[model samples]
Target: MMKLGFDGKVALVTGAGSGIGAAVSRQLAEEGAEVVVADLNGDAAQTVAAEIRSLGGQAQHIAVDVSDPDAVERLVQFVIDRCGALHLAVNNAGTDGVRKATADYPLDEWHKLLNVNLNGVFYCMKHEIAAMVQNGGGSIVNMSSILGCVGLPTASAYTAAKHGVVGLTKVAAIEYARMGVRINAVGPGWIETPLLLDHSDTVSTRRMVALQPMARRGTPQEVSALVCFLLSEQASFISGSYHLVDGAYTAH
Candidate 1:
């Protein structure tokens, strides 16, 4: 509904093979952005890209591990070489799904979680910002979590990593504000993504919805709309901020 601007621009989206990442990539493609769908599952990424092309959208696909600095660098360069420029980037790759309560969680488990969710975001921003600087300016949206602001049982690693994402987003936003680049983050609450599938039929999602004043979990598309606006020039004044698209989950 915001009718954001992406006409002729190029976007790079990670974890875009499914769920919220897929939704974001589709939304941008629909808005005339030439999107590069990056995911750990190369086949899935290719599938999404093909679907976008079928829907009268411009899209490409690439396999990337956002946690690896070298992979991130190559991904950025691929976008520039193929798409001509990189005006938008969404750092959405992460993991921690096999969530165990802190008391039972292993240190190695925690390390793996942080490697993807926190360090991965940092790697993406480092390479993406470098490219954006060369192109004058651009927009970046980092995927955080409602747990980034609030705490929940059995989500210690995820919470820590997401909070790190917010902190990283803020720092980058401030450091680059004067350079025409806007960096921000989205803290999605109980969204309908693959990450929630394990908890879908369980008491967790329902409990999460109950906690939300809106009384429901949000959809991938719902979050995508907010992200689209942030990437648009319309939100030029909005930067360095973490927006909670939680349907008032944090309000209570």
Candidate 2:
């Protein structure tokens, strides 16, 4: 394991309540970063924060709905007020919208999905980048998905939102690279997360395995490891890039 230091650095991870987000929060805290666990589920966020504290790591919890721009702004201010600075952020809060073909996808669900997955990242970056500029420099990782780079049957809304995330990340990276802020995106394949489990029946499991060249599902830790690297100085030269931790699912 490559050890990276985050001493005196503050990180904000949305969706830190579970899955990859929770894993990232714990790893960052273990590496000496004060982590803010933000999630729409208040209880889950608090649980993750408390667990970090028990391990003698610094962590705080905030209940937030990322789809709300006002709430995201408040989240940034809260971190500044409590931690005094925002040096890292992971815009990982998102939702898997209803699985349906584009022609059959409900308009309301499409709007709702885009609101959280796409617009939410933009709102977070808007506030997080401003804070980073004031603090000199920082790094940001936006959570996209393998679907972002390819189309999936019955997943029109999700694919569109994730694709938007990739585009947004690239634009922000170019606009702020000189200012010391590095923006990037992570495209994950089928991982062992609750969201995935919810849809994983025997049939789905076979399908997912067949899609990945590795012939298996990835663990949350696997994704978190990549995310931590991006947020660390180890990835100082990296920006405006979409990294796929997809078990070579897109290679074909």
Candidate 3:
């Protein structure tokens, strides 16, 4: 039998306060890993960690601003200091605001998307990889998007940023594959995350489903399922790979 256990290992998930990040943190803990739930929203992260603990799973909360290099370094150091070894990391933190045409996209919006979407991943990886290498080896999963693989109509900055994520994952994956570390990326399609619908999730999700081959959007847990598998040793031979879970959106 192929066991998907994470015994005696430590897993860190960024943006774990809610949505897919939270789902991944919970699932990883259920599989027997000591999980660090880090998010820019401290209270939210703590809440998720508490839920894991309530379920008899080991978890703790840390406030992390992935866009900030210093903060990312401290996050990795926290895992190393508290857990003694860092085994797995998920750079799942990101942001995408209202869609605007490239010609009208404000500079602030461009900077904002790039800062959290692309630069943040780089910051997390730099620190996480450094710590993982020191402790021998570890695995990393970067949360990219279908936007990372294909161009979207009005998501110029988001598309560009995600494309950068795919490139970064490939380069880093190749660089660390033989050195006891592996890096991969996950591209999620239109999911009904709270982040996607601040006001009307049901209506928004329906609109998105019209474009999907599945005739429905995905769930945070569904995305987390693939994420957990990629984080496990069962995926040992999978590195420098960008796995898509876009509900057949990209297939068309």
Candidate 4:
């Protein structure tokens, strides 16, 4: 029973205040990793970290806007200063901008979504890879989405950013494979996260459900399981690919 072994590792998960990111942070903590729960919401990040601590898990929290390269640098540095090494990271922070047809999409909205969704992943990876290389080796799981592989109407910006994430993951993984850094992307379907629920109406939700062959949305824990496995030694040979946890939403 290898159990995805993380006995003595330091893991950082962004957007970990809630949903899949939060679940991954907690699960990583349970696997004996010192977890750093990073999110844009300072209070939310602290709450999650405090909850992990209450459960006797070694955990910490930080508020970081991943879109800023400078802030991302500071974040990785913070992890090094506090934990001494960065063994694993999940660049999961992102946003689903307002829905609109590509032709009707607002220019500001497009930039805003890309800044956090696509550019943010790049920023985090840029710094995380450096820290991991310095530490000799590490793993990373960047959050993509079902949209990364396919397109959805009225979600032009989100779809584009996610697709970009997949490309970025592939290029980085290839570049760092020989350097002891394995990078991969996880594409989650319509998981029941605030990112979807907060933006969807009842009818919209039902429509999304119908789109999935599973006829339901996925749970954060389900996705977290996959993310943790990828970040663990069990997945040492897996890198430079996009793994989907979608409920077969893209099968059709």
How well does each candidate superpose onto the true structure, as a TM-score? 0.96, 0.98, 0.95, 0.97
Per-residue CA lDDT of model 4 for 45-97, tens digit only, reads 99999999999899999999998989999999999999989999999999988
Extract clashing residue pairs from model 1. Answer: none
Q: Per-model C-alpha lDDT, please? A: 0.91, 0.94, 0.89, 0.92
Per-residue lDDT of 110-208 in model 1, one digit per residue for the tens?
888898999999999998998998899999999998988998777899999999999999999999988888999999988888888767776665677
Task: For residue 99, give model 2's deviation from the true position in Å.
Answer: 1.0
lDDT of 2 by residue, 1-252 (tens): 687889899999999999999999999999999999999999999999999999999999999999999999999999999999999999999888777778999999999999999999999999999999999999999999998899888888899999999999999999999999999999999999988887787464468667788888999899999999999999999999999999998888
Model 3: runs farther than 4 Å from truth? 199-207
Record all residue pairs in model 4 with backbone atoms less than 3 Å apart, i.e. clashing.
Answer: none
Best by lDDT: 2
Clash number for model 1? Answer: 0
Residues 112-227 of candidate 3: C-alpha lDDT, one tens digit per residue: 88999999999999988888898889999999999888886667998899999999999999998878899999999978787666634455445566778988778999999999
